[model samples]
Target: MKINVMTDILEANDRIAAVNRQLFDSHKNLVLNLMSSPGAGKTMLLEKTAQALRGKLRLGVIVGDVETARDKERLEKYDLPVVQLNTGSACHLDANMIASALPHVDLTNIDVLVIENVGNLVCPAEFRVGEDFKIMILSVTEGDEKPLKYPLMFRESSLLLINKIDLLKYTNFNLDEAKANARKVNPNIEIVDISCVTGEGISDWAAWLSGCYKRKFGTNSLA
Candidate 1:
């Protein structure tokens, strides 16, 4: 006989995640789990999002990393309530981590909560943190084969942000192929091309976020 440790861990996490989902729903919060590989521009995109939706939406953030508050520090200047979770050796942020951090953030004060999961294409996709959507970023410099290489990440995500598109000329990343591959894995996944550095597509991303918030809150206006 053998113990299925991984199965047990996931089952435990799912139970916590369900509880978290109820709390978020009660607060009318639109939660998003943002995942990406290291250097894929997750922080930059969040920074841009903060700037874009400043007056329109009240945002909250949970920054997760192996051992740093650097990302948390970066978003604090935006005046958003940010909680930093240093996961130590954990490669992914499990539901228990989010449930523990919830007390640090006032869910009622935020229109949306974005959890920046530890920068990994693999483990992050395997865990559910009670998010309304799982959004992943793949930078052009990382190449187009990422969707195929990390099929589960694509399959699990609701949206695929093709980041660093301004640097496309410098890299051989094929946008068409990347979208095709992502669609192959997740047919309904929304794809958006963006550049945090150039400010391209930030409005579109913000609009999408606002739409989700409005839908969750049952409001007709973002204001």
Candidate 2:
């Protein structure tokens, strides 16, 4: 009975997600769903991305958290259209929540919309919020066993950013092993090593994102 209820809920959410996807597609917005555990550098990556892609791609963000609008506050300085979605008790942002927030954003103004999902690896991966891609961030300090333990997150993600590589010497996190483990679950997952602190790999990440936008819209002009 419990499983049936959960299944029904997901079905409903997927239907809403389809609607959201259709709306984004009509506006030619490349939406990215960013997922990670707490302190995995999701917001930092966005900060760097906003800086890197500024004046290149018009950007919008939907920050999702369980309670406070702290993350939303952090991103407001960029002067982009930023919307905060406080789930209250929900661990993940569903399609309905995203649909509710859509009115707050001008979809016609932005080329890319990044949805920063609640800082959770498990539940966030299970829900689709009408994103073009599911991008995961795994900080090196979190250890390499995550892919093996949380296989679903790895499998569902289109790209995985191994962040905080600047602290590689201080931590015992093995980069090779981590990549190996991630590929074990997701053979075709694109992985990039990045450090938001030193600004490493931010350009590569931005280029990849831009490439996605270009591929989708088939235009060189981001603006």
Candidate 3:
């Protein structure tokens, strides 16, 4: 009989993700698993987030890429505790990869642990990596039909950041339509229009993050 190996792998990954979740909960760290397609501004968002939260949050970043520490290098300027995870042939960051990196990061003092998953809309959304929130970045340059084309990513994410709004004037993308389509897939998803380059909506993003961090950790200051 034919077997679904993918199901078995996902189940195993989820178990590990549960364990990782407990570990993060113990420290009260708000772990956000960020996913997007290539050139969706994930790195720039991280840089801008770090800048916006400067004295308010203590951050740690784990960058997952198919190869190279390129994204990690880009984030180094922020001075956050950054770890680079090269997934080799793997296209997504599974729970085991996160488990492997946990020890390398200083979680005790971290208020938030951000996992910038490898740039893909499919597999990353399927694998659970012990995150409190799954955030997806959709740039207007990708066009507005993305929510329908990539329904799973839209459906699974807790927050959707409609990034690259700075390019709206140049593209045929409809902002309201994209937001409405995303809501169709996931009614509960919280979304924001942002441009990491122009520093727009970053303060709101940071404030949301800080509020979530405070709620999760139950503290106002970085411990």
Candidate 4:
């Protein structure tokens, strides 16, 4: 009975996700669902990405958190349209939560819509939020064995951002081993190393994201 109930829930979620996908397709916008564990730098990456793509892309952000509006406030500094979805005590953001926030965003004018899912490595990956791609961020501080311990996020994501590289010297994290484990689970996952503090490897990440947007929307410039 429990298994059946869980399946039904996912089926319903998928139907709603399809509707959201159609809405985004009609507006010619690319939606990216970003997932990560708590304090994995998802908000910081969004801030940096928004800043880097400023003027080049009509970007909008939808931040999901269990309660506070902290992430939304950080995104607002980019001066772009953003909505905050406080899920109360929910551990993850689902398609329904995203649908509820759609009314506050101008989807037609937005070239890229980034949904920063509630900071979680597990359940977020299990739910589809009507995104063209899923990107996951893993901080070196989270340990190198995360890929093996929590393989689902790495397996589900199209891109992985290995963040906090600036702290690598202070930790015993093995970059190669982490990448190897992730590849074993998902061989085609595109990995980009970045450090929000030092602004390292951000250009590559931005360029890749731009390419993805172009591939999905068919134009190079979001403007």
- TM-score: model 3 vs. ground truth: 0.95
Clashes of 2: 0
What TM-score does each of the candidates earn?
A: 0.95, 0.95, 0.95, 0.95
Return the clash pairs for model 4, or none.
none
Clashing pairs in 3: none
lDDT of each: 0.91, 0.93, 0.91, 0.90
1-223 per-residue lDDT for model 4 (tens digits): 3454445758888998999999999998889999999999988898888888878888899999999888888888889889999999889999898899999999988888999998888899988989999999999999988988988889999999999999999999999998999999899999999999999999999899789878877898755
Scored against the true structure, residue 176 in model 1 reaches a CA lDDT of 99
* Candidate RMSDs in order: 2.2, 2.5, 2.2, 2.3
Clashing pairs in 2: none
lDDT of 1 by residue, 1-223 (tens): 9876555758888899999999999988889999999999988898899899887887889999999799999999888899999999999999999999999899888878999999999999988999999999999999999999999999999889999999999998899999999999899999989999999999999989988887778783334
Ranking by lDDT: 2, 1, 3, 4
Q: Considering every candidate listed, which one attains the maximal lDDT?
A: 2
- Candidate 1: what lDDT? 0.91
Candidate 1, which ten residues in sequence have the lowest lDDT sum?
Answer: 214-223
Q: Candidate 2, overall lDDT?
A: 0.93
